[model samples]
Target: MASRALRAVVAVSTLLAAFTPASAQEAVVNVYTFRQPDLIKPALDAFTTETGIRTEVLFVDKGLEDRIAAEGENSPADVIVTVDIARLSAAKAKGVTQALEDETVNSNIPASYRDPENHWFGLTKRARVFYAYNARVPEKVMSYAALSDPRWKGRLCSRSGQHEHNLALFSAAILHWGEQRTEEWLRGIKANLSAAPSGMERDQVKAIAEGRCDLAIGNADQVGFMQTNARSPEQQEWAKAIHIVFPLFENGATHVNIAGAALARYAPHRDNAVKLIQFLSSPRGQQIMAEQNFEYPVEPRLKASTVVQSFGPLTADALLMDEIENTRQLASEIVGRIGYDNGPER
Candidate 1:
């Protein structure tokens, strides 16, 4: 009887421990993200609910690369997410992230949307579209290269050249047109600025509505957000003033950038981190991203959000996403030399 009691006690204690919250089950993954919180919260919620892996986010408005570089290998970050190829390539080049060996990631993500060396994968592909003042500019000005026609001088508004979004577009031009043609394009676009380079992208759209300029360069998601917002009358006005124009290269493909992720070099939860990466890149998570955030999924064949699809089918730029590693530095030099910040009248 005593022996039976002892066995039962041992079994009960073991069962209780197995069911209890232990360190393993309570593990947290640190994520460093450049995306606005609202954009990624739903996906984050689903990830935690499904896997029981807790998440902690550190949001950076600027200097993310410097922050991550400072942390070095001791960084608590398990994953890093951001938009544009320049920043992602910067992280990979700085050794802040490590190449992953997950077969699921390789299989689920298209080769075009991922690093050739497997260091990062693009989550969504967004076109660098133009936002034109519909009432002021004619539909005939559909091509991006048409912005340089001199007829629109002092009728354009843009974010500063230092902004990553602008830099990525310029980099794409450099890849497609070479330095000389790209320089000429930049010089001509500079000849058309309506105002000095100033303000955020949303502000650029607002400027268009207010008659500060007849056209601007902006991302598609921002336009969707503005048009759909319930409270802001100005957003509706901005939406009304603008129509999107997708630019095509000589080969007839549009330039695209992405929101993407990489595993940190010192990720403590290595296996779980890889699992989460795979999950996000998979068809299921990509769909969730599209539905929740208006982001186009990197997985081919999946329809994007209704708003994304409304922009119509896109033939994205065929350049490797990682080529920013080579293009960014040169782009910076070229942008300054061409005086993008000094305005068109310069």
Candidate 2:
């Protein structure tokens, strides 16, 4: 009986010891992210390594806003991270996110890329640029208007017309060139396709390399990914055949978008979440975002990736991102109306 009592006392003592440190070191941040693990893990590791803050991350591709809204004030999520302006804005409008007053984020991100209401801040920039076969497509055809030329007929390739990147570009054309002109532009480009819409940006580039098409519409980041570490000889050959072109002023420069973050409305670790937001928007964080991820830093002083630099300077479209927030519906209608599903003519 004495031995059994002694054993019980030791178990209690061990449990108390474990609980003490956990209670004392209770500062932890839980982040919900839509970004791919490989792209954002480096920054997450760097933040934890430098700050001694414990972090837990969950990656989900969709329905984050709905989940958080359902959780109401009981949600354990501290920060919500995602790419693209539309997703970020939608989260804010849904009231599952809260505004931040972090000086670092506000001062670092340009007004053009961030929410005017301070609910979210952009971490990186991505521009809609064209990838073309250097041997076939002339670099002078950089503007969206130029794509309408008859010379480009039966010589273009791209992802689904319903994709967000293309939708943003089409909306940019509508903003600058008018609805009639935009629709005409869409029809002209559709006429030029060498194949029915594929589902990926990389495939569009591949089509260009294979001589199935002369030009492809995509973001510049994919070009960098291809040039750096080609998984195969075919990809390397494709890389060799392609050159990037930033569209012109009449398209209103390259329409740049962002990957951004907002505080969860029910953030359990409210203070830690704010700290993380500040950290991500600071110079150190921005530099890591640029150098490691090949994204344009929100901070003005940090240089773009060398691959991005090769494309030369861009004058991004001046239209507000919010203006075309409903482009998904519009794009679906436009693409369907023009019969993009049908492959090019024989």
Candidate number with greatest lDDT: 1
Worst 10 residues of 2 by lDDT: 16-25
Candidate 2 error regions (>4 Å): 1-25, 230-233, 326-328, 343-346
Give a tens-digit lDDT track for model 1, residues 1-346. Answer: 9999999989966743443334433566777788877877788778889888867777876877677787666566678888877778878888888999788898888888888888888888877888878887766336667778888888888899878888888888888778898888888888899867899878989998888899888887788888788889778777878887776777777778888899988776677678778878888878887666666887768888888788666777778777755687788898899888998664
Per-residue lDDT over 176-234 for candidate 2, one digit per residue giving the tens place of the 0 to 100 score: 77678778888888787877888687777788887888887888777777777645666
Candidate 1, residue 8: lDDT: 94
Instruction: Give the Å error, residue 50, model 1.
Output: 3.0
